[model samples]
Target: MKLLFLLKEGFAGFRRARLAVTIALATITLSLALLGLFGLVAQNLSDSFQRVFYQIRLEVFVDPSLSESDFQTLKSEIERIEAVQSAEYISPGAALQEFEKDFGKDLVAVLESNPLPPSFRVLLKTGHSRPEAIQAVVRRIEALKAVDEVVYPENLIRLLDKYFLLGILIAVGLGTAIFAISTLLIFNTIRLAIHSRQRVIEIMRLVGATDAFIKAPFIFEGILQGLIGGLLAAGLLWLAGDLVRYLFLPGLSVPWLYLAGLVAVGVLLGCIGSYLSVGKYLNA
Candidate 1:
């Protein structure tokens, strides 16, 4: 029952069943690594969606022939809309300049004259990026005099929004399922490992061994397995993140803090698995 004796027993058990312990740890590492990658991607995608949502604009191009007073009136009307964030007017020349910047100077030179129209780029408030909401605002703008076109890339935005939502749901569901299965696998592995030494456990139980005395070594062994698994999973995830970033997104490597957080989560899962499995057998 002493701490030193318990530690020695745990170490002896680990030494006696190194193969099974190693296998369980390796399986936990692989499974946790997959889960961590899924978590990282879901978090990043949600963040990207938020940033894009804030940046989306509902453009209202105006008739270039409108007088200064008419333009001012139109701008005022747009500003009064509930979902309007801010509005900026782009003159025909400015529109042409923006196009030139995108296409190149030679392309701009080929144009006989600037064909781009003056427009008002309207940034929307949060939650106003939905198609129906944008359409309502667009309709209101179109009804005003001297407005030529109202553009918001409605179809593209809707598709992106839908896909983002779908991706997030799928990722979350898959991650959860994988984690559950991994926990069971690791738990059973430890249970079987302990079961292989039933003679030792039964002997201890018969010779005035308290339940805690018998369970201590197994619990310690579980903790050791969990720590090793968490570390391996964390390392693999970090490496995979680098490979993915290099292959696809040049500046997109996993953040160190996020990786560390994932490892911590893995450790928790491992402990929970081990505790449950060992506890059940101990009770039995």
Candidate 2:
């Protein structure tokens, strides 16, 4: 019975201050929408970087004059390294074929002799894609007897490292700003609702109502507004998902789990803001 009365009063507060509630709802919706968009972009960029990282591999060219047994021994030794995932041997003929496939030119036909060095296309383990890890792996492989040269994309690794760090800092800074602004707006909205009903609060207090009862309805009102705003924001993101993918990231897709988390955050923010606002008024 008490819960029902509190819910009724909460809905009634919305009717009492329709314009203020609308502005608060709109602010929450916009804030959440911006946050969701930024999250999607950051996710896509991180994925792209991971894809590039996995593509990086070391090309270990070995001495071509070794016997078949020695070559196999060298390949096995390279594969035994801690960071090496697998070492695939490329023979002179296979190397010539790959050169032709990549450059659309028959190197063997042009030179009339296959001079391409036999190399091991060395793939690293999952957690060993960074520049430092790759360099450490290279140093170990180069120390082997038959390895002529160990080469990987040095500049590309450094570039990815630099950009990925920059992206993280930017995402954290913007996300914090958006959350702070949304909290302030919701707090002010609840505060205004309390101010508008100041006389009723005093009358209820004089008639023996506790502070808890007086604050319950305003908290409920804030939560309802937040719920509506979250729903609207999630719907907007769903509708814009395809367009965002086309314009920004071809592989971008907003998962249902992410949208659910966004809604949860909105509800939590509303609860905290309203609780703090009402607490301030009651204490004052």
Q: What is the C-alpha RMSD of each candidate to the true structure, in Å?
A: 3.7, 4.5
The best candidate by TM-score is 1
Cα lDDT tens digits for candidate 1, 1-284: 49999889877877898887777777778777777777777777767767666457877888889987888888899989888888888888888778778976744467777778889999888878777877888888889888888887777778876786777678778878977777777777777777777788778878988887888778887777777777887888788778888898675647888877766766676566656766676677
lDDT of each: 0.77, 0.82
TM-score, model 2 to reference: 0.75
TM agreement with the true structure for every prediction: 0.78, 0.75
Cα shift from native, residue 214, model 2 (Å): 1.5
Question: Which one wins on lDDT?
Answer: 2
In angstroms, the error of model 2 at 69 is 8.6
Candidate 1 deviates by what RMSD?
3.7
lDDT tens per residue, model 2, 63-130: 99988898889989999998888999999889988888899987767888888999999988888877
